[model samples]
Target chain A: MFLHLFIVNKSGGLIHHRSLSSKAPKLGTNEWLRIGSTFHSLYAIANEASPVKLPGNKKNGADDGIEEIQADGMTLNCFQTRTGLKFVITAEPNTTAAVDLGQILREIYMLYTDCCLKDPFYELEMPIRCELFTQGVENLIQKYSRIR
Target chain B: MSRTPVNILDRPLGGRGSRAETQVSLSAFSYLYSELVQYHQNRVDSISELERRLESSGYDVGLKILELITYRNREYKREIRLMNILHFVSTQVWKAVFGKPADSLERSVENTDEFMIIDYEPLTSTFCSVPADFGQLSADGYMSGIVAGVLDGAGFSARVTAHSVALEEGEANNNNTNTSSSSGGAQSGNNGSLLPPRKEKAVFLVKFSPEVLERDAAMDR
Candidate 1:
C-alpha cells in the first residue's frame, strides 16, 4: 500500500519527494538529495534532446510549453482521503501504472493549489508548507496502509 | 408628459433586492486586482502615467466584457430602455465586475447632452502608484477606455477620460471652483480626489454628440 512520490520538472528530473506510508523504507537525506539533483540534470538533458520548435518554418524564439520524451517518464503519486489531505510520492520511470500515477499526481496538484497555494501563508515556489496538505497526506497514507 | 417607463429596478443589483446570477470570490478578485495594479504600476513615471497605464489595461478587458454583458442582457430581453440601460450599467454591470455599483449618475440639466456615472471606488486603478523608473503608463487611461467601451456598448457615444483631481490643502476652490452647468461643456478636473479614498471612486463622463441630442429631441416630438 505504500507509494513513492516524486516531482519531476519539465525536464523529467525529480525536484521533490515523499513516501506514502510511514512503514515504507525511508530514503537517506543524502540519497534523496542526490536523487533530486540527478533527476534535475536528466530533465535538462531530456529537454535538450527534444528541443521543441514551431512547425511551418517558424524559427520561434523559444519552445511553446509543450515537450515530452519517451525514455522512461517520471511518476508523481498521491494518497488521499475523504477530507482532501494528500500524501504525495514521486519517482523516475519506476511505477507499474504510469497513467494512473499521473492522474493521482494531477489531483494532488489541484488539492495543493486549492488549499496550500491559495493559502496566504504559503509562499510561491517554496516547499509545500500547508497544514492541510500534510494532514491530508498523512490521513491518506494511514487509510491506505491499513487497507493494503 | 409621456415619460419613458422607468426600469431602474429591473437589474440584478437594483433596489428591489434581486440576487446576482453568478458569484465570484472576493479573495480571487482582490488577488487578481492587486496583481493587475502592480503590473501596471511597474515601469511608470508620474501619477498621471500610472493612471493611463491602468486605464488602457482595463479598457481592453472592458471592451470584451461589455460585449459579453450586452449579449447576456439581450438574451434575457430584446430592446432595452435607455434609462434602464444606464441603470443596468451603473448597478448590475458595475457590481458584476467590480463588486459594487457606481456612486452616482447625473444628467446635465442645461444642454441635456451629457450624463455622468461616478464611482467612489474604481477598482481598475486601485493600488496603482507610479514607480520612479520609465515615465509613461496611465492606469487611469485604461479605466477610461473601459468606461468608454461600456458606454458605447450601451449606445452612448462619449469620450471617457480618467482624471486625477487631487485636492491640495487649502486649494479646494482653486481645484474645482468653477462647476459648469452646460452639457459637454469644459469639465473641471477638480471634481474629486484622484487617489482612491481608503476606498476608490471613479467618475465616468457620458457626453453625447450633438446628433444624439437631435435624435432624442425628435423622439420627444
Candidate 2:
C-alpha cells in the first residue's frame, strides 16, 4: 500500500506532499522540509558514490543512480526525470510493484503538466495545489487500492 | 463536507493553487497545433487570412500568458518601455512557452519602428512541412499572434507577422559541416541526418504603433 508521496524540485525544495494512508506517521511541516532536502542530497551523493569505471564497461558506472531505498519495513522509491525533477513515493515493504509505482509517477507528472504548467495563471517552481491535480492523485490511489 | 462547488476555471492559478513544475510531451503539442493549423487552413481562402485566424487564436493566449507571467514575476509595476517589453517577450515569454529563449532579437536596420525575433527551429513548425507549391506558408503565424497579443496586452499596440527564410545552400552546408565536425562518429548513427531539410527558420516581425514612438519621444524629453 502507498503511504505518502513527495515531489522534490531540482533545487532540493519540497514542492508537494500527499499522504495516502491514515496509518502513516505525521511529521511537522518543518520536518517534512528537512526530509525533502536530505533526500535530495542523498540522491546526489548516491550518484557520486557509484563505483568508478567498471572494467570493460564503456558506459558510465553511475548511469542509473539511487533508485530505491528499503528501511524499517517501508520502501522508498525515487524516480528522477532527465530534467532533474524527483518523485519519491513510500510504500509497504515487499510490495514488488516497482513498475506500477513508475507508471503512477509518470501519470502524476502528466497531470502536473496539464493542470499546473500549462495553466495560464500558474507560476513556475511553486507548490502544486491545483484541484484537478489533487483529484487525479486521489483517483490513482483509489484505482491502485482496488487493483491490489 | 458539503460545500458549494466552484468552477475549475474560476479558481486562482498561482501560489498554492497547483503544482507548477509539470511538463507535457512535445509530440502531443505538435499534433494539437497541426490540427489547429489545418482547421484554420480549410476555412480561409488566402494565406494571409489563415495567418490572421492563427494570430487571433494566439492573441487570446498571449493576453492570458502575459497576465500569468507578470503575476508570477511579481512585477506589480508593469514594463512601460518598448525595448523592455520586447526583451521580456523574447526571453521570458519564449522560455515559458518553448522551454528556451529566442535565438536572436534585433531592431530592423531600415525601419526604426520595426523589430524582429528569430527562432532557428520554431516549435510549431517542427512537425510541419509545406508543399512546394504553397509559397510562404509557415506555421509560425501562431507565434506571431502570441507576440502581437503580448504587446497589445501590455499596451504597446503592435502588428506582428511571421516570415519563413530559406537558408542558402552554402549556409546550410556550412551548418551541416560544423555539426559533422563536432560529432564525427555520432553523425553516422544519428537519425535526424537522414531526413531532408524542411523549413527550419522563422522570423517574427513586430511593428509598433506610431503612437508608441511618440510616447517614447515624450518620455525621453
Candidate 3:
C-alpha cells in the first residue's frame, strides 16, 4: 500500500502533498517545505558525493543519485525530471514486487502536464492548486492502490 | 470544423507526430512568416526589439514541443547531463522541428560556456525576404529563442542566439550531399571550384548560465 506522495518543484518547494493511507505521517506544510528543500539539496549533494563515477547509462546521466531507499517498513522511490521536479512516493517495503512505482510517477507527471500546464491561469513552478490536477492525481493513485 | 469526436485527453497527442507530418509549402511558410514579421513590426521601434518579440513567441512553442516530445519518449526525461541534452537538441529537437538534423555542432574554443550548432539552410532564413531597412536582423533570431526555451525547460538555462556567417569551403560540399536537392550547381557560376564557397550559414550560439556551469563543474569533481 502506498503511504504518502510529494511533488516538489525544481527549487525544492513542496508544491503538493497527499497522504494516501492512515499509515502515512501527517506533515505540516512548513515541515513538508523543509523536507522538500532538504531533499533537494541532499539530492544534489548525494550526486556529487558519490565515491565512484558510475559507469554511465547512455539513457541516463552519470550524476543520477539516490533513486530508491528501503527501510524496515517502507520504501521511498524518487523519480526526478530533467527539470529537477521530484515525485517521491513512500510505500510498503515489498510493494516494488507488486507495483511499478516509476511508472506511476511517470503517469502522475503526465497528469501534471495535462491538468496543470494546460490551465492558462497556472503559472510555472507555483503551488499546484488546480482542482483538476488534484482530482486527476487522486484518481490515478486510487486506481493503482486498488490493484492489490 | 470537422473534429475527432473523442475527448482531448483520450486522443493521443499527435502520435509521434508522424500522421500529421505533411509538408508545409515554402510559399505558405514565407507568407506566414511575413505576416508574423509585419505584426511584430508594427509594435516595435527597433530591430532588436522586433527580434525579442519574435524570440518570446517562439519560447512558448519550444516549451510545448519539449513537453510533448518528453511525454512521447520516456528515455528523454532521464537525461541529466549537459552534453547529453545538447546532443538530444541537435538531433531529436532539430529533427522534430525542422525535418532534418543541423549541419554540425561545435564548442567555442574561446569560451567554455558557449557552444554552436551550424545549419546550412535554416528553414527560418533560407526563404525569408526581410526588407533592407531591417538592417542585419536574421529571422533565425526566433529559432534561437526556441533553443533557449528547450534548454531552460530542461534545467540547462542557457542563452541561445543565432548568427549568419561565411560558409567554409569543405562545408559547401557536405551540405549538397546531405540535402536531397542537387541545386549546388546553380549556387554559383562556372568558376564554382576556384571561388570561395557561398556564405549562407547560420550558427546557433548557446551560452550556459553561471549557475548551470557551477552544477556541471560540481558534477565533474
lDDT of 3 by residue, B59-153 (tens): 88888879977876675545678898898888888877765787789999999999998888776654343444666777787788888888988
* TM-score leader: 2
DockQ, candidate 3, comes to: 0.01
Alpha-carbon runs more than 4 Å astray in model 3: A1-148, B1-23, B177-198
Docking class of 3: incorrect
lDDT of 1 by residue, B1-221 (tens): 99777585653432223343344343354346555555655676555666666666766776677777757666546323446666777876676566556667888677476677765445444334333243444334655677766666656656666554443454322212221111111211131122112222355666666765666567766
Q: After superposition, how far is residue A18 of candidate 2 from its true place, in Å?
A: 56
lDDT by residue for model 1 (A1-148), tens: 3346554433333434677645445887567756655655543344356555557423321233212222344444334332322334544444433244444454556445444444433444445545455555565445444543
What TM-score, over all chains together, does every model reach? 0.39, 0.50, 0.50
* Fnat (0 to 1) per candidate: 0.00, 0.00, 0.00
Ranking by lDDT: 2, 3, 1
> How does model 2 score on DockQ?
0.01
Note the DockQ of each predicted structure: 0.01, 0.01, 0.01
Which ranges in model 1 have alpha carbons more than 4 Å from their true place? A1-148, B1-23, B37-53, B70-82, B109-111, B125-142, B164-200
Docking class of 2: incorrect
Off by over 4 Å in 2: A1-148, B1-21, B168-199
